[model samples]
Target chain A: MGEAPLSWPDGNDRVPYWIYTDQGNYERELEKIFYGPVWNYVGLECEIPNPGDFKRTQIGDQSIIVVRDAEGGVNALVNRCAHRGVKICEQDKGSFSEIMCPYHQWTYDLKGNLQGVPFHRGVKGNGGMPADFSMADNGLDVLKVHVRNGGIFATMSDKTPPFETYMGNRILGYYDRELDGRSLSLLGHSRQRIGANWKLMLENIKDTHHASLLHVFFVTFGLFRVDNDSRVEMDDTGLHTALSSIRGKQELNDGTAQMRSFDSNLALNDPSLLDVVREFDGDQTVVMQTLWPNVILQQQSNTLATRQIVPKGPNSFELHWTFFGYEDDDEEMTARRLRQANLMGPAGLVSMDDGQILERTQEGILAHPNEQGVVELGGRGTDDADHMVTEVALRAFYKGYRNVMGL
Target chain B: MTITPELRSEIADLANAYALAIDDGELDRWPRFFASDCLYKIIAKENFDSGLPLGLLMCDSQGMLQDRMEAFSKLNVFGPRSWRHMLGAVYTTGSEKEISARTNFVIFETLAGKDTHILCAGEYRDIIIREHGALKFRERLCVYDTTMIPNSIVRPI
Candidate 1:
């Protein structure tokens, strides 16, 4: 498979199906993209607010442990043990004094410094090392950590640019708009394993064109309509994008339009389910910002969530959704967020179609591995679009993907 | 007040009727087993134990449940499937005004071309009450143990 010459089309708009089904390409992605010069979301800093609090997550398949030291600084370390390649911490999240390997009693400090060994010296003077072992040299591999608005990011490569620089001003401004200096309280978490390439999940999120078409709940309930005032903004590098739509009612008088079902008479039995409290200062009722590689920050109505995409293999990925709200939210506000949470997870009313659609995409593509997918909704380029009905974001994703994967 | 054998039988029938309504694709009738103002939530057992106010499906009123049924029937796109619910012994306490019943359940799902698999295993903490001379659930909290849901849980368990 490696001998086969793989190349993207001339305009980088046509994506080959083999990219989603090839094991060789998947391994190359792990090496070039996940372990390369790119920042990956480890966990939330608020998740480990107090000293000794820790959470175990993953960067691709590599296990990572993010903990708060005694000095209140965050640290992210590879979960692999130095002596033997075994995971030190197994639990998802906990508060611990030290990280100890379950296989052997090799212990490390909260900062991932090797602190102790079960039998460094000869226990009974029968057999021991030459006594020249240095604990500092045996510490767990630690990655450069960065925290912005309580979101923790880490990269294994030193060549990776600063987190803010990588995100650029436009993307950083978007994050600031939502999470600037505000503490996030973990509302809940839900995980869904999608049977498709990880890129497909990211594409599904950035495809703003499908919001009203595929998810009838969005149009039928007036959450979003095609005629609504909306825009898709992307950074200069086309690595990130922010798609938003202001709240608007569906237009029923558009009789000349081909799609008349957009004005369906179906209505929510309980209109309170579609109620909006206008938490944000603008008319933007829906905001979805996708950071290149694998992070999505979403504000759908009052429900706020951050999604971390972890690729399992060529044909599967796991999405970790951490639902959150402001730390200063009152009871009614929190309830509104919880009620609106029904709009976006594995069981979300408007978003559940994504899972099935992604699966069917993978299944369909596997049938014709040599075929190319044509993505020309708005045009064959990666630029910001003035309208929401466009596939420019998908093209932008493929552009960044080609750059990272060095295709 | 003591729960007599006749009352227990009626409660069991109510539970069976509710399960059958969902399993037999009679989603329109599923909301009829609940009171007008009911709380129906499907939460992971971890969240329920930790007192986290989150649920996969959190419906505070019968209206929301009816909306969900309508959405599943009209709008959602999912493969052909069937659900079978098995309930264990129901332990009841409290009076007729508000009876607290705890029962174990295991739901098996059979997809279009796949074998039947254990979709969920959980316990239901129900608050049953007498409304309109019938036993109906005022609060039905389905707390399941599986945290990582498979594909998508489109239907109610």
Candidate 2:
């Protein structure tokens, strides 16, 4: 309590405002949570199918280049060049046989192995690199990468557990359900920069309380609601959460009468927007999972996507959406995936309200850095719940966060 | 079939009227600019160039457009704001049935108490046809170059 500026109260229900606003805490989060022994989502294997295909992305605030090598294997490398610390890959994505820092032309193979340095041999040995300078000793920083199904994740620390063990058993089931060993093809992407604490975005999906209340499209269309059959499950470490809900028809009863976002009169003129074709083996129409620290896997109807959260600062994050569908999907199925995509993303009918809400939440938190948010909706205990009326997953999330961050 | 000067003038008027409808805050009339069976999509240029079929907003029929505008006006929660849509010339090149037109556009948004900023910068690749006597958009593809949308896009661009 001496050097710490935050005065946290007991229990996971009390989330202090300082965690969202404090610069010191933010730095610690970057170190312990992001760069620490945790697997961070980089990109998908399908996004880089061909050898030499590469995509420049982020892990926390650090730039990462996820590339497929000539050997048809995926690799994750720090974007910074080993020579002059220059960002090697400037473009978002492209097919590159080799990487060269635009600043000095320091070259590297697709595996990020230092291939050549222009001045290393230096003009017929006049000003060359030292005799002991080895290319193997000076390669772009590599991260331990795990590519399973079609998804790709990387970890900076060696102490991080394997991908399967890290995700735990419960969360892995949900993760595999989406990927399912199917060949995935890229649909598209929509990016947004939100001015708010990054964790709020995670909490936003983890919290089912706002789904039926804040989104009119969700409530009016019966896509998700508290009354619907829903389940909230977390990983053993409580670092990941999956919220699944079966879509029910909207009815004007005691439940709908109490809500402000729902309107019986409001209906889609084109009902084809909700023309959901049952594909998965479950009755649940929505499965939104938060893969701690980075990505959110969204499976709302036929719209399948990964919302990658790249934290820019203490109070801001860049959300990168990678929309995809199975390669074997017929033209009609592809169209369905494309059509259903309107329900999420930046201009999503049901999701467009989220970025603004998070920014507003950040604004309020910045105003009152001493206050804390109440997470006692479902009680203090973090347990699996079969109902939507619970903040248990959030409490579990913070518990995992606090354990890793040592808050 | 022929490209007449009168037809060009009519197309220009249609484009201006479309911009004025939203800038004037008459979101109710937003869907009227399109034909009954239309395609109005707000897509990123990256995806467009890459042949990706996704969009920030994708509406196939006029009914879908109405649904989108309805969601924006009635239920979607966002700060009160206004836009100033600045458009360049609507270039027209066509066939005997419909005219294919493209125009560069930029929209600046200002919240009630905030300063004005560039909300989006993109080109509208459209297909124009006559619904009754007036020209209506059969397909309005808003391919925006702004990769990162500055917060939320509450209203359609």
Candidate 3:
């Protein structure tokens, strides 16, 4: 595989379409990028708190089983059986003494060690064990699993940098802020299949410039303001960057009234829903931290979640979103979390439009490769840029992508 | 354990009518099955008693339920389908203002060319209100036995 003459835009400049709608590039991505020496988010530590508790997950299209072994250590391994390449585990999540394959009743322990097989000694010794067959040698393939502040991450290639080095101080600090001495409880899930490249979705989030415009629902309902200012940071590591504090029109005076749409205003007809409680006295931020290729950590307003993008193909991808809150949250706070959950997923009022928008973006890119998607926004003159609600974050993302993918 | 003939017949008819209204896409007429100012929620039983406020569907008031109906009719996009509700049992607890009833429901959906199959199987916990010479639902909680949802749950269960 030959490397492309790749470079990140200085600021707001156009980007190549191969990053979005190329099947060959997408396949290369799965090999040299996703399953490469990059840290991939598998699950959270709180997901399987108990020793025997486990959650089935996938890392770069490889079906994996994330479990807490008898010693309360997190372990991630390929769910495939060594015998017939059948998936060893079937259920989504549960606590089990052993992962037993329903196909032939072959059993394996929580550590993914092949324990027993059905009828090892057949009648009259007709079918016994091979001379070289060993259960210890045929255990499930385990990857390098690591955790930071209850967040679990796995890397297929053991050659990748340590987990802390991969996430860097900025990301680790962000996780510390949210998971602040609190355990997460699985609230529920919302899944949607978008008709676009998975890369488009990730790039879309990193592109904060399009937020106020594409998601008019945010600005129209006064939920998120467009008439605000922010800065984008291009980290020295190239892989790490942050979209800084977003400032919005906090107060309006004079004859300049708010713009309210019929659907937006009419949908939330309940006055209580609009009731003015205490304001959120925290940093009004929309930080998008991308961990190389597959992981996207989003802190959009009050609703926060990690979106693990698994590309089904060049044109399609399955995004699995898991929403959680601290276990110590009061009943009222939990209710507020639930209400805010409607702001992100496919059914979310603010985000339901993203799937369609991404599809359209992919379609346009597929139609025209040379017509580059411009990323020139915050980077006006300076080589280094500040975080702004624009394409600056995306410019930073692709810079990292090029460096890692060697494209 | 044993269902009374009179109550069973009435409940069976009511359940059938409710399913008919919803499956026929008559969401506006569907509210007739419940009283005004009701609590309509669809939660997995795994999360019911655990204090998880979130649900696949949660509507606290009749207005919210209507808002959901409005969303489905105007905004929601999904394949067309008809459904059959196989309802069983009616355990009732009567009070002055309302009656609490428990019933099991198995919903079967038949899409365009697909054969009818079970979409959801759950138990409904309903609070029936009798006020001003009228009987309606004050609260209806569809607590699912299984948490694995097939695809999109576009309509009220």
For model 3, the stretches where C-alpha displacement exceeds 4 angstroms are: A1-12, A117-127, A229-231, A234-241, A244-282, A285-288, A299-302, A363-371, A379-388, B1-36, B42-53, B62-137, B140-157
Per-prediction CA RMSD (Å): 1.9, 1.5, 5.6
| lDDT computed for candidate 2 | 0.89
Global lDDT of model 1: 0.84
Output the worst ten-in-a-row residue range by lDDT, candidate 1 chain B: B44-53
The estimated TM-scores of all candidates read 0.96, 0.98, 0.77
Interface root mean square deviation per prediction: 1.0, 0.7, 4.3
Off by over 4 Å in 2: A1-4
Give the DockQ (2 decimals) of all models: 0.74, 0.87, 0.17
Per-residue alpha-carbon lDDT of model 1 for B54-151, expressed as tens digits?
A: 78788888789889988888788788999999999888998867889988999888988878988788999999999999999999999988756777
Candidate 3 TM-score over all chains jointly: 0.77
- Provide the overall lDDT of each model, using Cα atoms, as 2-decimal numbers: 0.84, 0.89, 0.66
TM-score of chain A of 1: 0.96
Candidate with top DockQ is: 2
Model 1 spans with C-alpha error above 4 angstroms: A1-5, A253-257, A260-263
